[model samples]
Target: MTDEQPDRKESGFKETTRVRTARERLRETVAGHDRTERVPLDAADGRVLAEAVVAERNVPHYPRAAMDGFAVRAEDTFGASDRSPEILRSAGEAASVEPGAAVQVHTGSELPEGADAVVMIEHADERGGDLEVFDAVGAGENVAPVGEDVESGQRLYDAGHRLRPSDLGLLKSVGVREVEAYEPPSVAVIPTGEELVAEDPAPGEVVETNGLTVSRYVERWGGAATYRDVVTDDPDALREAVERDSDHDVVVTTGGSSVGERDLLPEVVSELGEVVVHGVALKPGHPVALGVVEETPVVMLPGYPVASIVNAVQFLRPATKWAGNLPVPDPPTTDARLDRKIRSEPGVRTFARVSLTDEDGERVATPTRASGSGILSSVALADGWVVVPEASEGIPADEVVAVQDWEALP
Candidate 1:
């Protein structure tokens, strides 16, 4: 523990800790435990490849025609032109086509025996039983040489590579019917609160949504999520839920990390496992917790949407990415000027929702009315946001910032 404690007079949480230090611990906990699986090519999308796929054969294994033309030796068309055309007899089979004769061929068709070039169909005129070439072509012209696209035993993809839709087509073209990839990490989220309800809520009960938020974020990082029922602010119930979900790669419990009498997540985590971090120095997310149970990492997020989403974006998503060896997705962003000034407490990171406007071809960002962490619509209505770091004050009006988008660009 620490000699200095957080000043919780203004905040509601009992514990306080640094955000970066806690995140480093979580990263160490999630590394080096990824699992692998073999799946058909159809199921490889969005999966991290565990093995490299190599080409089995040459693409266009033979010397094939690259256009609809008459196949002939380069010497036959060396000086042929519109002014002085070379008339060659059209022969039937390879055995019948002697020197100075052209063989009929189409796109992708194999070149006839002893033919080293092709005269495009448009450049050749059919005259009775012969083809009159009006344009000269050099050796190997208009022909697809062997291994032109891909060579045999060429490495197509390397391990730790994430598969995309276009990657599937390339894998098929390389003659790979299946692939070995990391299995998606499995996460179990258990929401705990006495005043939370599932489907129908009483007059004072709140509908549980943090579990859904955590689960959805987990899935985005190539992880499978299972949300358990709310544990009702009981230590025993929370412990049971955590123990039951130990088989999963990560166990998450939302709510009940405060000093309130009903809050039992911290106590349950301490009793059933080990609580490494009780609170993070993040605004609207100070009560966050991190622990381990039955060799499984457990993350405790605040019940509020703002805290849950930010923590998920900062913590759970990254952990899942490491577990699956996934490539970090790039979020599209735009540079904008702040519409107004915003302030923050020292040594604490804060996130705010902002709506954007185009002011004379320049984007301006204004803070949204939804400042409370529990206001889901605030974030939904926002175009994007600007995050203030822990060591700084707030941004001044007109200060340009990068607003990260919810989706990445193609």
Candidate 2:
């Protein structure tokens, strides 16, 4: 474990704090400690599996017909076609099963005990008890053999796989009524600071929107947002909230993370639990904090709306996925030419909101004005954000940058 001691002189900010690289800080924040639960297949949508799901039996269960036609030995219809037809009488030699077969089978019906192929209805003609066969089919031409779709004892899905609609259908087809899935990690979000309030506040009071946004993200990531409330910038109150909400797997507190007299979140977190990480080397979200309270992971984020959200993407999102036993997917990215130059401080990763538009049949990005930490509206208005690496001072116009997707493309 790397040290998170304060390194105030690195950035020349009035308040100096130790900061870890984005990846290092994220690694220090551990996943929630929780067990698995069994959920019905229908309710397991979007949930991650805790165990492998194996097929109990083969798909289709038996060899079946694949078309409405006569089931017969492929050799019997040899040289059969429009110009060269084979006439076979339905006498004692070939019993009259249906209009033209020893026995006619509809599509999907089980093939007769000895049949190896099906002669489609279009390939046969009935003429007063005498059948003319044409368009000969080879063996296994129209037969769906047992285990053709899936084999018995096959591992249909492995642990840590997120269930999709198609996966549900496959599970249903394989007769899986319930599955072992990781229990949804319970999360408690506490929005702190005297300037914050749950309800509409007087002028200058910022409404508590971070908790709502965090809650939605938690739910979307397959974790349950069990509690959301506001707390004043008091270490005692914050400690009380942590102790009371220790039942949850993770607790999040927004605001009061900076090293100011009013910023007592760090102190409260340390008093109640162990502070693992204090800050991150990322623009708009440098004050992000990580700790553990009573064995439950606790994350403290900056008060600014954009900062909170960006930190959520960088930290909370992955933590939720890990808690749910889900295999994390690479963050969505797209390549587009930069429309203008954007500067950034060295040694800090920057996420800039950008609007993607089609200019003369090419996709171009327009950086939004709400690139600041306080602007939440830009997140909704922009298509996605562009990630600027710490190694580069800035990105020049016409340079191809990978833009993260925020909404469905137009």
Candidate 3:
């Protein structure tokens, strides 16, 4: 084994602790390199743009009327209201021609020459071809001037922006039909273990479900997922699998991350590539292996379901964002008072499952007992997870803590 490998006892526990700040680990894992590609605007939904999108023309290119009313000078009806009505000739005297005239206008119609404002049709009455206006209108009212919605030569969107429905509408309004966006990164997931089988497993073997979980998350974040056949603790088979799938942006393997006698993922990765970070300082996912195999990033996740998921959130999400030329949003969180006390190690950050409930008009958090990575059911029942940092020993009851809602995942 290389000098970077941690010493593990027969009981599956490490001899020395390897603690790293979340930011440090993330920086060490990602090197900021990215691959770019172009895609059609219709398929660019939720994808990040690699270049800035400038406006070709101003929105609503012409000044137009916003309501169906009489276009007249504000000075014509200075005090015209319900109490005092102003009478004026509808035709040649005030310049009128049915609905399309120099004085009368309809909704969204162009303003006639010499007209500056529109008085609602309801506010005026016909009196022998003349009009009696009761409401006073202001100049430039009910009118959308040119370049009011969008200015000419404006920077509509910047690079690294993920397109949403509203953003698509803005692009369309500005006459942009296509865009240059980065292609999503492709991720290959390899599940390892002898007793583990596919979802439909044989007798005495457990079904492998971590790949499915990982794949779902990768696609959710605009990354492609590729699932490979299972490798049963054989270093040569694992090496071959990594080599075959080296074209992918990221390769994630479940199980065999620790230094157990049967665990050989670390050794295989070292032989094929260089291991940058052998372990993390977080609970339930400390044995994670982060490295690069032939210029492609590889992450070896722990076997337990919960541990695998936590590692994905911490490492895989950021890596996927970097590869796809996207920016990762801050993890969704809400502050709530803790209902019970929770303990943790001083050097390791702990994630505890929690359920939120309203009590006395305030949110109270109730923690779950499934703290281990193997217990997947507990996570299913939890609304979110509360984070405890590395420097703190434990959080006391009624302390406000940040909780991540599981439903926020797409």
Q: How does each model score on lDDT? A: 0.80, 0.76, 0.78
Candidate 2 or 1, higher lDDT: 1
lDDT of 2 by residue, 7-42 (tens): 323432333233334445545555645598899988
Decoy 3 TM-score against native? 0.88
The C-alpha stretches of model 1 lying farther than 4 A from their native spots are: 1-18, 68-70, 81-98, 101-109, 120-135, 356-364, 407-410
By lDDT, the better pick of 2 and 3 is 3
Look at candidate 2 and give me any clashing residue pairs: 6-18, 7-18, 8-16, 97-102
Instruction: Choose 1 or 3, whichever is better by lDDT.
Output: 1
Candidate numbers sorted by lDDT from highest down: 1, 3, 2
Off by over 4 Å in 2: 1-22, 25-34, 88-107, 121-131, 406-410
Candidate 1 lDDT score at position 382: 86
Tens-digit per-residue lDDT, 1-410, candidate 3 = 54445444343445324444543554554544455777666777898887899887787776667888777766687788888888765754244333323276777777666777777889988778677889888888888777778877889888888899888888888888888877788889898988887678778888988888888888997888997778898888889998998888878899999877768887788889877676677877888877788888888889989999888887787787776777878778888899999888887888888888999899999888767789988777888888788888989988998899744753
Worst-scoring 10-residue span by lDDT in model 2: 91-100
At residue 177, candidate 2 shows an lDDT of 89
Q: Write down the TM-score of every candidate.
A: 0.86, 0.88, 0.88
Model 3 residue 301 CA deviation in Å: 0.7
